[model samples]
Target: MKNIFIINGHQKYPFSEGKLNSSLIEKAEKFFNNKGFSVKKTTMEDNYDINEEIEKFKWADVVFFQTPLNWMGVSWSFKKYIDEVFSMGMMGEMSDGDGRSKEAPKKNYGLGGKLNGKYMMSVTANAPKEAFNNPNETFFNGISEDDLLKPMHLNFKWFGFETMPTFMAYDVMKNPEIESDFKRFEEHLTTNFK
Candidate 1:
């Protein structure tokens, strides 16, 4: 029974509402629940404790962050959750200023994460897949999902957690192939841990 931590950072307080993020979160919850794994879930709307998240992280063999891409980046709520859930006193001496950290302080991380012996992955949904593809003309960047999420991946790697391949569902909002993406995602979930 591998313990899993799932964070659904769809904020309803500091912002208006996020319907798609809610749906994706529910879908992910059911997916893990159906697998009979022990799962701990947190939604941004629920004023939950960061300690609970830490305890879950300590208990989990794996952690999954599932949510929609709000800006050209991750949701503000997700960033806040990361700040709260992965803050100091939890990372031991492995965190920054302990001398093991090699990251430049200007790059947005400072030895705060240390997910030793655990695995982490992401399920990110983006608005338009085509916009992020190579050779695109509009306001776009040509980076791949793994590249786009390199910061998060490296954060886990620095903390001693093995990071898995990021799973992305692009063109999620306007594409007609969303159901297909969901099916693929379902298959990904089943085969991922194996």
Candidate 2:
């Protein structure tokens, strides 16, 4: 059976209640459980043990992240989680982790990845999808997803995770379309993991 880890990267703000990501996490848990996969979850709103999180990453076959786009970046809570957890010497556990040492040159920077067979996928809620495709829009150079998610892609790659196709919701604040978005999310999960 596949082991799956899901992270709800939502943070409560004055205007945003973080309900969308909460619902998504619930849906994912139910879906993965019904599929007979071994599922693990982390809700960013809760207090987490850093070592446990690292262990979860090591144990899972795949990791799924559901996040909201805040000012073109992940929420501060989620970012802090990453910064703290990854900084706890997890990268050293990846491969040799001493690529900069004299024994291993910096040229082999990406060779030290422990979770080589693992995979990751992210679903982010942001502005309308049309804004990304419009050439006249200067917000993201017509590649909003890539523009916003490149850092995450590279970080996951450095950790030896093959990336799955990303899923996104557009115009969340103005018009949520929650039901349709959930349907597409289900489709995405089924299609990618099946």
Candidate 3:
């Protein structure tokens, strides 16, 4: 069995109400539960613990960040969690490609991660996919999912852990698409965990 940490990085906001974020998070939670993984969940509005969550991160075999993308970026909760959690370790350490420091945590030891061996992925809800896909919009267009999450991915890489492919729900909250997104989140968990 795998240990999973689900970080609900959504803080209550105007655009965050009654949408894809809420539904998919519930779905993700149920899906993980059925898999028998010991799960720890943290919601943004709750007072957070840096060391405790980091300990959870170390305990996890897979860490899932379920959130809604806002302002063409991640939620403040996600950013705060990252800032608090990743700072405790030698998060950004790197040596020549050929070798790493032996005295400190190394990738081989799993402690090297900034929390390592643990897999991580992000499941995000966004506005209509088209809203973000156009090339004409200077601030929000012509960027693909991986491109948008480059900084985040780089952060994971800097710590020497592999990032799992993300699950994105576009135009979430409109009509039947919300249901489909939840279904996909469940599938994502089952597929990855198995």
lDDT (Cα, tens digit) per residue for candidate 1, span 1-194: 36777777555544436665566667767877887877887777677776666677667777777656666456687778776665543456334433233445455344454556555454545455665557563455576666666667765565556676566777655564667777877777777765
In model 2, the worst 10-residue window by lDDT is 89-98
Clashes in model 2: which pairs? none
Better of 1 and 2 by TM-score: 2
Query: What is the overall TM-score of model 3 with all chains considered together?
Result: 0.76
**C-alpha RMSD values across all candidates:** 4.2, 1.9, 5.0
For model 3, residues 101-154, the per-residue Cα lDDT tens digits are 666545444224443545555556445666566798666667777688777776
lDDT of the candidates, in the order given: 0.63, 0.78, 0.66
For every model shown, what is its TM-score relative to the native structure?
0.76, 0.91, 0.76
As a whole number from 0 to 100, the lDDT of residue 164 in candidate 1 is 60
Q: Which numbered prediction scores highest in TM-score against the true structure?
A: 2
Identify the runs in model 1 with alpha carbons over 4 angstroms from their true place.
12-16, 89-114, 117-127, 133-141
Candidate 2 has a TM-score of: 0.91
25, model 3: CA deviation in Å? 2.1
Using lDDT, give the best candidate's number.
2
